[model samples]
Target chain A: MSLQVSKNGDVVVIEVDGQLIVGNRQELKQRVLDEAEGGARKILIDFARAGYIDSSGLGVLVSLAKRMRELGGDLRLANLNDDLQTLFELTKLDSLFQIADTRERALESF
Target chain B: MHAALDIRVPSDVQQIEAIVAQVVRRCREHRFDGRQLSLNVPVALTEALSNAILRGNGDAAGKCVRVRAEVTEMRLVLEVEDEGAGFDLEACTEDPTTPENLEREDGRGLFLMRSLMDRVERFRGDGNVVRLTLNRR
Candidate 1:
Protein backbone atom coordinates (compact mmCIF):
# COMPACT_ATOMS: atom_id res chain seq x y z
CA MET A 1 0.00 0.00 0.00
CA SER A 2 1.18 3.56 -0.74
CA LEU A 3 1.14 5.93 2.25
CA GLN A 4 0.93 9.71 2.25
CA VAL A 5 1.97 11.60 5.37
CA SER A 6 0.63 15.04 6.26
CA LYS A 7 0.32 17.18 9.35
CA ASN A 8 -2.78 18.71 10.90
CA GLY A 9 -1.29 20.80 13.64
CA ASP A 10 0.96 18.42 15.61
CA VAL A 11 -0.99 15.34 14.63
CA VAL A 12 0.55 13.50 11.71
CA VAL A 13 -1.98 11.81 9.44
CA ILE A 14 -0.95 8.95 7.12
CA GLU A 15 -3.34 8.10 4.34
CA VAL A 16 -3.19 4.50 3.17
CA ASP A 17 -3.97 3.57 -0.42
CA GLY A 18 -4.97 0.04 -1.46
CA GLN A 19 -5.57 -3.13 0.49
CA LEU A 20 -3.35 -3.75 3.50
CA ILE A 21 -2.25 -7.37 3.42
CA VAL A 22 0.64 -9.54 4.55
CA GLY A 23 2.63 -8.50 1.48
CA ASN A 24 2.64 -4.87 2.60
CA ARG A 25 2.29 -4.94 6.41
CA GLN A 26 5.97 -4.36 7.01
CA GLU A 27 6.03 -1.21 4.93
CA LEU A 28 3.20 0.23 7.03
CA LYS A 29 4.80 -0.75 10.33
CA GLN A 30 8.13 0.82 9.42
CA ARG A 31 6.47 4.01 8.28
CA VAL A 32 4.63 4.40 11.59
CA LEU A 33 7.73 3.62 13.59
CA ASP A 34 9.64 6.18 11.58
CA GLU A 35 7.03 8.77 12.43
CA ALA A 36 7.36 7.90 16.10
CA GLU A 37 11.11 8.22 15.90
CA GLY A 38 10.77 11.63 14.32
CA GLY A 39 9.00 12.85 17.52
CA ALA A 40 5.46 12.64 16.24
CA ARG A 41 3.58 11.70 19.36
CA LYS A 42 0.09 11.51 17.90
CA ILE A 43 -0.38 9.65 14.60
CA LEU A 44 -3.48 8.92 12.58
CA ILE A 45 -4.03 6.40 9.81
CA ASP A 46 -6.69 7.58 7.37
CA PHE A 47 -8.24 4.65 5.52
CA ALA A 48 -10.32 6.65 3.06
CA ARG A 49 -8.66 4.95 0.11
CA ALA A 50 -7.98 1.57 1.72
CA GLY A 51 -10.58 -1.07 0.90
CA TYR A 52 -9.72 -3.74 3.45
CA ILE A 53 -7.00 -5.23 5.62
CA ASP A 54 -6.12 -8.86 6.25
CA SER A 55 -5.27 -10.49 9.56
CA SER A 56 -1.59 -9.79 9.13
CA GLY A 57 -2.38 -6.15 8.57
CA LEU A 58 -4.46 -6.10 11.74
CA GLY A 59 -1.59 -7.66 13.69
CA VAL A 60 0.77 -4.96 12.52
CA LEU A 61 -1.69 -2.30 13.63
CA VAL A 62 -1.95 -3.90 17.03
CA SER A 63 1.81 -3.97 17.40
CA LEU A 64 2.07 -0.35 16.32
CA ALA A 65 -0.54 0.69 18.85
CA LYS A 66 1.34 -1.07 21.61
CA ARG A 67 4.62 0.47 20.55
CA MET A 68 3.21 3.96 20.34
CA ARG A 69 1.70 3.63 23.80
CA GLU A 70 5.04 2.55 25.23
CA LEU A 71 6.62 5.62 23.68
CA GLY A 72 4.20 7.86 25.64
CA GLY A 73 2.26 8.62 22.46
CA ASP A 74 -0.48 6.81 20.54
CA LEU A 75 -1.58 5.89 17.06
CA ARG A 76 -5.22 6.27 16.02
CA LEU A 77 -7.23 5.11 13.04
CA ALA A 78 -9.90 6.99 11.14
CA ASN A 79 -12.25 6.74 8.15
CA LEU A 80 -12.50 2.94 8.32
CA ASN A 81 -15.25 1.53 6.17
CA ASP A 82 -18.02 -0.67 7.51
CA ASP A 83 -16.18 -3.92 6.77
CA LEU A 84 -13.06 -2.74 8.51
CA GLN A 85 -15.10 -1.69 11.52
CA THR A 86 -16.56 -5.15 11.71
CA LEU A 87 -13.14 -6.75 11.42
CA PHE A 88 -11.85 -4.75 14.36
CA GLU A 89 -14.97 -5.51 16.39
CA LEU A 90 -14.70 -9.23 15.67
CA THR A 91 -11.03 -9.28 16.65
CA LYS A 92 -11.78 -7.09 19.72
CA LEU A 93 -9.14 -4.58 18.70
CA ASP A 94 -11.58 -1.72 18.62
CA SER A 95 -11.11 -1.17 22.32
CA LEU A 96 -7.34 -1.18 22.06
CA PHE A 97 -7.17 1.86 19.82
CA GLN A 98 -9.13 5.07 19.38
CA ILE A 99 -11.01 5.14 16.08
CA ALA A 100 -12.61 8.24 14.66
CA ASP A 101 -14.97 8.71 11.76
CA THR A 102 -13.22 11.59 10.07
CA ARG A 103 -9.80 13.17 9.67
CA GLU A 104 -10.89 16.29 11.47
CA ARG A 105 -12.26 14.35 14.40
CA ALA A 106 -9.10 12.24 14.56
CA LEU A 107 -7.00 15.37 14.54
CA GLU A 108 -9.14 16.83 17.29
CA SER A 109 -8.73 13.62 19.28
CA PHE A 110 -4.99 14.04 19.22
CA MET B 1 -24.44 -26.14 -12.10
CA HIS B 2 -21.54 -23.68 -12.05
CA ALA B 3 -18.19 -25.21 -12.87
CA ALA B 4 -15.74 -25.60 -10.04
CA LEU B 5 -12.55 -23.57 -10.00
CA ASP B 6 -9.23 -25.30 -9.55
CA ILE B 7 -5.94 -23.43 -9.34
CA ARG B 8 -2.53 -23.64 -7.72
CA VAL B 9 0.24 -21.21 -6.91
CA PRO B 10 3.75 -21.51 -5.57
CA SER B 11 4.45 -20.51 -1.96
CA ASP B 12 4.69 -16.84 -2.79
CA VAL B 13 3.12 -14.06 -0.75
CA GLN B 14 2.40 -11.92 -3.78
CA GLN B 15 0.06 -14.43 -5.40
CA ILE B 16 -2.45 -14.02 -2.60
CA GLU B 17 -4.09 -11.07 -4.35
CA ALA B 18 -4.82 -13.05 -7.50
CA ILE B 19 -6.19 -15.99 -5.57
CA VAL B 20 -8.48 -13.86 -3.43
CA ALA B 21 -9.66 -11.94 -6.46
CA GLN B 22 -10.52 -15.13 -8.30
CA VAL B 23 -12.41 -16.61 -5.36
CA VAL B 24 -14.37 -13.40 -4.79
CA ARG B 25 -15.26 -13.04 -8.45
CA ARG B 26 -16.47 -16.62 -8.66
CA CYS B 27 -18.46 -16.34 -5.47
CA ARG B 28 -20.02 -13.13 -6.68
CA GLU B 29 -21.21 -14.92 -9.79
CA HIS B 30 -22.85 -17.50 -7.53
CA ARG B 31 -24.87 -14.77 -5.79
CA PHE B 32 -22.73 -14.31 -2.68
CA ASP B 33 -23.85 -11.29 -0.72
CA GLY B 34 -21.99 -7.99 -0.59
CA ARG B 35 -20.62 -8.64 2.90
CA GLN B 36 -19.40 -12.07 1.94
CA LEU B 37 -17.80 -10.83 -1.26
CA SER B 38 -16.05 -7.86 0.32
CA LEU B 39 -15.14 -9.09 3.82
CA ASN B 40 -15.71 -12.77 4.44
CA VAL B 41 -14.31 -14.11 1.16
CA PRO B 42 -11.17 -12.00 0.94
CA VAL B 43 -10.23 -12.00 4.63
CA ALA B 44 -10.86 -15.73 5.11
CA LEU B 45 -9.11 -16.69 1.89
CA THR B 46 -6.13 -14.47 2.53
CA GLU B 47 -5.68 -15.88 5.99
CA ALA B 48 -6.03 -19.45 4.80
CA LEU B 49 -3.73 -19.01 1.81
CA SER B 50 -1.08 -17.07 3.72
CA ASN B 51 -1.05 -19.64 6.48
CA ALA B 52 -0.77 -22.42 3.93
CA ILE B 53 2.13 -20.65 2.23
CA LEU B 54 4.10 -19.26 5.17
CA ARG B 55 3.34 -21.56 8.11
CA GLY B 56 2.28 -24.86 6.52
CA ASN B 57 4.64 -24.88 3.55
CA GLY B 58 7.33 -22.85 5.30
CA ASP B 59 7.60 -20.71 2.18
CA ALA B 60 9.63 -23.39 0.43
CA ALA B 61 10.45 -22.42 -3.12
CA GLY B 62 9.05 -25.60 -4.67
CA LYS B 63 6.03 -25.97 -2.44
CA CYS B 64 2.63 -25.04 -3.84
CA VAL B 65 -0.80 -24.21 -2.43
CA ARG B 66 -3.63 -25.81 -4.35
CA VAL B 67 -7.03 -24.12 -4.29
CA ARG B 68 -10.31 -25.70 -5.35
CA ALA B 69 -13.72 -24.11 -5.14
CA GLU B 70 -17.28 -25.23 -5.72
CA VAL B 71 -19.63 -22.29 -5.85
CA THR B 72 -23.38 -22.84 -6.05
CA GLU B 73 -26.36 -20.61 -5.58
CA MET B 74 -26.67 -21.63 -1.96
CA ARG B 75 -23.05 -21.50 -0.85
CA LEU B 76 -19.36 -21.31 -1.68
CA VAL B 77 -16.97 -24.06 -0.65
CA LEU B 78 -13.20 -23.73 -0.98
CA GLU B 79 -10.44 -26.15 -0.15
CA VAL B 80 -6.88 -24.90 0.15
CA GLU B 81 -4.17 -27.53 0.29
CA ASP B 82 -0.61 -26.99 1.44
CA GLU B 83 2.45 -29.19 1.06
CA GLY B 84 2.85 -29.68 4.77
CA ALA B 85 3.03 -32.68 7.05
CA GLY B 86 -0.33 -32.49 8.80
CA PHE B 87 -2.65 -30.20 10.68
CA ASP B 88 -4.15 -30.99 14.06
CA LEU B 89 -7.31 -28.99 14.52
CA GLU B 90 -7.49 -29.64 18.27
CA ALA B 91 -3.97 -28.49 19.02
CA CYS B 92 -4.34 -25.22 17.06
CA THR B 93 -5.76 -22.94 19.74
CA GLU B 94 -4.36 -19.49 20.21
CA ASP B 95 -6.65 -16.74 21.37
CA PRO B 96 -5.56 -13.39 20.03
CA THR B 97 -8.20 -11.60 22.07
CA THR B 98 -6.57 -12.46 25.37
CA PRO B 99 -4.59 -9.70 27.03
CA GLU B 100 -1.34 -11.62 26.88
CA ASN B 101 -1.72 -12.61 23.26
CA LEU B 102 -3.21 -9.34 22.10
CA GLU B 103 0.14 -7.66 21.52
CA ARG B 104 1.73 -10.76 20.01
CA GLU B 105 2.53 -10.54 16.33
CA ASP B 106 1.35 -14.00 15.25
CA GLY B 107 -1.70 -16.26 15.94
CA ARG B 108 -4.43 -13.98 14.59
CA GLY B 109 -4.62 -15.57 11.13
CA LEU B 110 -6.30 -18.73 12.38
CA PHE B 111 -8.75 -16.72 14.43
CA LEU B 112 -9.66 -14.52 11.48
CA MET B 113 -10.08 -17.55 9.26
CA ARG B 114 -12.43 -19.26 11.68
CA SER B 115 -14.35 -16.09 12.39
CA LEU B 116 -14.98 -15.14 8.79
CA MET B 117 -15.82 -18.54 7.32
CA ASP B 118 -19.14 -20.21 8.08
CA ARG B 119 -17.36 -23.52 8.56
CA VAL B 120 -13.64 -24.29 8.67
CA GLU B 121 -12.41 -27.88 8.84
CA ARG B 122 -9.05 -29.54 8.29
CA PHE B 123 -8.19 -32.81 6.57
CA ARG B 124 -5.01 -34.70 5.80
CA GLY B 125 -4.87 -36.48 2.47
CA ASP B 126 -2.35 -35.56 -0.19
CA GLY B 127 -1.55 -32.55 1.93
CA ASN B 128 -3.06 -30.39 4.66
CA VAL B 129 -6.40 -29.20 3.33
CA VAL B 130 -8.35 -26.34 4.88
CA ARG B 131 -11.95 -26.28 3.80
CA LEU B 132 -13.78 -22.97 4.11
CA THR B 133 -17.48 -22.59 3.47
CA LEU B 134 -19.72 -19.53 3.32
CA ASN B 135 -23.45 -19.94 3.07
CA ARG B 136 -25.32 -17.54 0.82
CA ARG B 137 -27.71 -15.15 2.50
Candidate 2:
Protein backbone atom coordinates (compact mmCIF):
# COMPACT_ATOMS: atom_id res chain seq x y z
CA MET A 1 0.00 0.00 0.00
CA SER A 2 1.08 3.55 -0.76
CA LEU A 3 -0.05 6.96 0.44
CA GLN A 4 0.26 10.28 -1.33
CA VAL A 5 -0.48 13.63 0.25
CA SER A 6 -1.68 16.62 -1.68
CA LYS A 7 -2.83 20.06 -0.68
CA ASN A 8 -5.98 21.67 -2.00
CA GLY A 9 -6.49 25.16 -0.69
CA ASP A 10 -6.22 24.65 3.08
CA VAL A 11 -7.30 21.01 3.00
CA VAL A 12 -4.80 18.17 2.86
CA VAL A 13 -5.76 14.99 1.03
CA ILE A 14 -4.10 11.69 1.80
CA GLU A 15 -4.75 9.21 -0.99
CA VAL A 16 -4.48 5.52 -0.25
CA ASP A 17 -3.52 3.43 -3.24
CA GLY A 18 -4.21 -0.04 -1.87
CA GLN A 19 -6.17 -2.05 0.61
CA LEU A 20 -5.75 -1.02 4.24
CA ILE A 21 -5.23 -3.94 6.60
CA VAL A 22 -3.18 -4.82 9.66
CA GLY A 23 0.03 -5.03 7.67
CA ASN A 24 0.00 -1.33 6.72
CA ARG A 25 -2.50 0.40 8.96
CA GLN A 26 0.24 1.75 11.19
CA GLU A 27 1.95 3.49 8.32
CA LEU A 28 -1.27 5.19 7.29
CA LYS A 29 -1.93 6.23 10.88
CA GLN A 30 1.55 7.67 11.23
CA ARG A 31 1.20 9.56 7.96
CA VAL A 32 -1.98 11.27 9.10
CA LEU A 33 -0.70 11.90 12.61
CA ASP A 34 2.33 13.50 11.05
CA GLU A 35 0.09 15.62 8.88
CA ALA A 36 -1.88 16.71 11.90
CA GLU A 37 1.30 17.52 13.76
CA GLY A 38 2.52 19.55 10.83
CA GLY A 39 -0.44 21.93 11.03
CA ALA A 40 -2.89 20.27 8.70
CA ARG A 41 -6.18 21.26 10.27
CA LYS A 42 -8.49 19.76 7.66
CA ILE A 43 -7.60 16.35 6.25
CA LEU A 44 -9.38 14.19 3.74
CA ILE A 45 -8.52 10.54 3.23
CA ASP A 46 -9.21 9.82 -0.40
CA PHE A 47 -9.76 6.14 -0.96
CA ALA A 48 -10.70 6.23 -4.62
CA ARG A 49 -8.00 3.72 -5.48
CA ALA A 50 -8.45 1.69 -2.33
CA GLY A 51 -10.87 -1.17 -2.49
CA TYR A 52 -10.64 -2.79 0.90
CA ILE A 53 -10.05 -2.09 4.60
CA ASP A 54 -10.10 -4.45 7.54
CA SER A 55 -11.17 -3.47 11.03
CA SER A 56 -7.62 -2.56 11.99
CA GLY A 57 -7.64 -0.01 9.20
CA LEU A 58 -10.98 1.21 10.43
CA GLY A 59 -9.49 1.43 13.92
CA VAL A 60 -6.71 3.58 12.62
CA LEU A 61 -9.16 5.87 10.88
CA VAL A 62 -11.25 6.15 14.03
CA SER A 63 -8.13 6.92 16.02
CA LEU A 64 -6.97 9.47 13.49
CA ALA A 65 -10.36 11.15 13.37
CA LYS A 66 -10.41 11.38 17.15
CA ARG A 67 -6.90 12.72 17.21
CA MET A 68 -7.71 15.31 14.60
CA ARG A 69 -10.75 16.35 16.58
CA GLU A 70 -8.72 16.67 19.74
CA LEU A 71 -6.41 18.95 17.77
CA GLY A 72 -9.32 21.18 16.72
CA GLY A 73 -9.28 19.65 13.23
CA ASP A 74 -11.21 16.94 11.44
CA LEU A 75 -10.71 13.96 9.15
CA ARG A 76 -13.09 13.03 6.36
CA LEU A 77 -13.27 10.16 3.89
CA ALA A 78 -14.01 10.30 0.19
CA ASN A 79 -14.41 8.03 -2.83
CA LEU A 80 -14.92 4.82 -0.91
CA ASN A 81 -15.91 1.96 -3.21
CA ASP A 82 -19.17 0.08 -2.71
CA ASP A 83 -17.49 -2.76 -0.79
CA LEU A 84 -15.74 -0.40 1.53
CA GLN A 85 -18.90 1.59 2.02
CA THR A 86 -20.77 -1.56 2.95
CA LEU A 87 -18.12 -2.32 5.54
CA PHE A 88 -18.55 1.08 7.17
CA GLU A 89 -22.30 0.66 7.24
CA LEU A 90 -22.08 -2.92 8.49
CA THR A 91 -20.01 -1.83 11.46
CA LYS A 92 -22.27 1.20 11.96
CA LEU A 93 -19.30 3.42 11.38
CA ASP A 94 -21.08 5.21 8.54
CA SER A 95 -22.63 7.43 11.17
CA LEU A 96 -19.35 8.15 12.94
CA PHE A 97 -17.47 9.96 10.18
CA GLN A 98 -18.37 12.27 7.36
CA ILE A 99 -18.05 10.36 4.08
CA ALA A 100 -18.19 12.10 0.77
CA ASP A 101 -18.90 10.74 -2.66
CA THR A 102 -16.14 12.55 -4.43
CA ARG A 103 -12.90 14.37 -3.76
CA GLU A 104 -14.41 17.63 -4.83
CA ARG A 105 -17.25 17.25 -2.39
CA ALA A 106 -14.97 16.21 0.41
CA LEU A 107 -12.64 19.12 -0.23
CA GLU A 108 -15.57 21.49 -0.26
CA SER A 109 -16.83 20.08 3.02
CA PHE A 110 -13.58 21.02 4.70
CA MET B 1 -8.47 -24.36 -4.92
CA HIS B 2 -7.78 -26.86 -2.25
CA ALA B 3 -10.81 -28.61 -0.87
CA ALA B 4 -9.26 -28.13 2.55
CA LEU B 5 -6.35 -26.09 3.84
CA ASP B 6 -4.58 -26.11 7.16
CA ILE B 7 -2.24 -23.18 7.67
CA ARG B 8 -0.12 -22.27 10.66
CA VAL B 9 1.53 -18.92 10.99
CA PRO B 10 3.06 -16.74 13.68
CA SER B 11 0.79 -14.62 15.80
CA ASP B 12 1.55 -11.29 14.26
CA VAL B 13 -0.99 -8.88 12.84
CA GLN B 14 1.34 -8.10 9.94
CA GLN B 15 0.88 -11.65 8.67
CA ILE B 16 -2.85 -11.19 8.28
CA GLU B 17 -3.11 -9.33 4.95
CA ALA B 18 -1.41 -11.98 2.89
CA ILE B 19 -3.40 -14.75 4.50
CA VAL B 20 -6.63 -12.92 3.84
CA ALA B 21 -5.63 -12.32 0.24
CA GLN B 22 -4.77 -15.95 -0.26
CA VAL B 23 -8.08 -17.08 1.14
CA VAL B 24 -9.97 -14.64 -1.02
CA ARG B 25 -8.04 -15.72 -4.09
CA ARG B 26 -8.83 -19.35 -3.46
CA CYS B 27 -12.48 -18.62 -2.89
CA ARG B 28 -12.56 -16.71 -6.15
CA GLU B 29 -10.96 -19.58 -8.01
CA HIS B 30 -13.60 -21.91 -6.67
CA ARG B 31 -16.43 -19.65 -7.96
CA PHE B 32 -17.61 -18.44 -4.59
CA ASP B 33 -20.00 -15.53 -4.88
CA GLY B 34 -18.21 -12.47 -6.15
CA ARG B 35 -19.57 -10.46 -3.28
CA GLN B 36 -18.13 -12.96 -0.82
CA LEU B 37 -14.84 -13.16 -2.65
CA SER B 38 -14.50 -9.40 -2.97
CA LEU B 39 -15.92 -8.30 0.34
CA ASN B 40 -16.92 -11.07 2.70
CA VAL B 41 -13.90 -13.32 2.41
CA PRO B 42 -11.23 -10.69 2.91
CA VAL B 43 -13.04 -8.78 5.63
CA ALA B 44 -14.11 -11.83 7.58
CA LEU B 45 -10.77 -13.56 7.23
CA THR B 46 -8.88 -10.45 8.21
CA GLU B 47 -11.03 -9.99 11.26
CA ALA B 48 -10.61 -13.63 12.25
CA LEU B 49 -6.85 -13.60 11.87
CA SER B 50 -6.55 -10.26 13.57
CA ASN B 51 -8.59 -11.53 16.47
CA ALA B 52 -6.51 -14.70 16.59
CA ILE B 53 -3.19 -12.89 16.51
CA LEU B 54 -3.93 -9.85 18.63
CA ARG B 55 -6.71 -10.70 21.06
CA GLY B 56 -6.49 -14.47 21.18
CA ASN B 57 -2.72 -14.77 21.43
CA GLY B 58 -2.09 -11.35 22.99
CA ASP B 59 0.61 -10.80 20.35
CA ALA B 60 2.84 -12.83 22.63
CA ALA B 61 6.18 -14.05 21.31
CA GLY B 62 6.57 -17.56 19.93
CA LYS B 63 2.83 -18.02 19.92
CA CYS B 64 1.12 -19.28 16.77
CA VAL B 65 -2.22 -18.93 14.99
CA ARG B 66 -3.73 -21.88 13.15
CA VAL B 67 -6.12 -21.46 10.25
CA ARG B 68 -8.17 -24.14 8.52
CA ALA B 69 -10.36 -23.68 5.46
CA GLU B 70 -12.86 -25.90 3.71
CA VAL B 71 -14.07 -24.51 0.41
CA THR B 72 -16.69 -26.03 -1.84
CA GLU B 73 -19.22 -24.82 -4.38
CA MET B 74 -21.76 -25.02 -1.60
CA ARG B 75 -19.97 -23.03 1.10
CA LEU B 76 -16.73 -21.80 2.60
CA VAL B 77 -15.81 -22.47 6.21
CA LEU B 78 -12.79 -21.06 8.01
CA GLU B 79 -11.53 -21.63 11.52
CA VAL B 80 -8.86 -19.56 13.21
CA GLU B 81 -7.45 -20.68 16.51
CA ASP B 82 -4.92 -19.02 18.77
CA GLU B 83 -3.04 -20.29 21.74
CA GLY B 84 -4.49 -17.95 24.33
CA ALA B 85 -7.18 -18.13 26.95
CA GLY B 86 -10.69 -17.93 25.58
CA PHE B 87 -12.32 -14.56 25.28
CA ASP B 88 -15.64 -13.36 26.70
CA LEU B 89 -18.29 -12.99 24.01
CA GLU B 90 -20.30 -10.56 26.14
CA ALA B 91 -17.41 -8.14 25.99
CA CYS B 92 -17.11 -8.46 22.22
CA THR B 93 -20.76 -7.68 21.51
CA GLU B 94 -20.95 -4.20 22.99
CA ASP B 95 -22.33 -2.64 19.79
CA PRO B 96 -19.60 -0.46 18.43
CA THR B 97 -22.22 1.58 16.59
CA THR B 98 -23.62 2.87 19.85
CA PRO B 99 -22.87 6.55 20.34
CA GLU B 100 -20.86 5.74 23.44
CA ASN B 101 -18.65 3.25 21.59
CA LEU B 102 -18.63 4.68 18.07
CA GLU B 103 -15.23 6.26 18.31
CA ARG B 104 -13.63 3.31 20.05
CA GLU B 105 -11.43 1.27 17.73
CA ASP B 106 -11.30 -2.05 19.60
CA GLY B 107 -14.68 -3.65 18.89
CA ARG B 108 -15.44 -3.65 15.19
CA GLY B 109 -13.56 -6.83 14.26
CA LEU B 110 -15.90 -9.19 16.05
CA PHE B 111 -18.97 -7.28 14.94
CA LEU B 112 -17.95 -7.43 11.28
CA MET B 113 -17.20 -11.12 11.49
CA ARG B 114 -20.70 -11.85 12.73
CA SER B 115 -22.32 -9.57 10.19
CA LEU B 116 -20.44 -10.64 7.08
CA MET B 117 -20.27 -14.36 7.60
CA ASP B 118 -23.29 -16.66 7.42
CA ARG B 119 -22.19 -18.22 10.68
CA VAL B 120 -19.68 -17.24 13.33
CA GLU B 121 -19.28 -19.65 16.20
CA ARG B 122 -16.53 -19.64 18.76
CA PHE B 123 -15.60 -22.49 21.04
CA ARG B 124 -12.59 -23.54 23.03
CA GLY B 125 -10.58 -26.65 22.22
CA ASP B 126 -6.77 -26.45 22.06
CA GLY B 127 -7.29 -22.71 22.28
CA ASN B 128 -9.84 -20.04 21.34
CA VAL B 129 -11.28 -20.93 17.91
CA VAL B 130 -13.41 -18.68 15.73
CA ARG B 131 -15.24 -20.55 13.01
CA LEU B 132 -16.63 -18.55 10.12
CA THR B 133 -18.94 -19.95 7.47
CA LEU B 134 -20.21 -18.39 4.25
CA ASN B 135 -22.69 -20.15 2.02
CA ARG B 136 -21.67 -19.88 -1.61
CA ARG B 137 -25.26 -19.43 -2.77
CA shift of B17, model 1, Å: 0.8
Q: What is the C-alpha lDDT profile of model 2 across A53-109, one tens digit per residue?
A: 988899999999999999999999999888998998887888989999999999888
Per-residue error at B67 for model 1, in Å? Answer: 0.8
Assess each prediction's global lDDT (C-alpha) against the native: 0.89, 0.87
The segments of candidate 2 whose C-alpha lies over 4 angstroms from its true place after superposition are B1-3
TM-score of each: 0.95, 0.94
Off by over 4 Å in 1: B1-3
Clashing pairs in 1: none
Q: For each candidate, what is chain B's TM-score?
A: 0.94, 0.91
DockQ values, each candidate: 0.77, 0.81
* Residue-wise C-alpha lDDT for candidate 1, range B60-104, written one tens digit per residue: 898899999889898888899999886787788888898878777
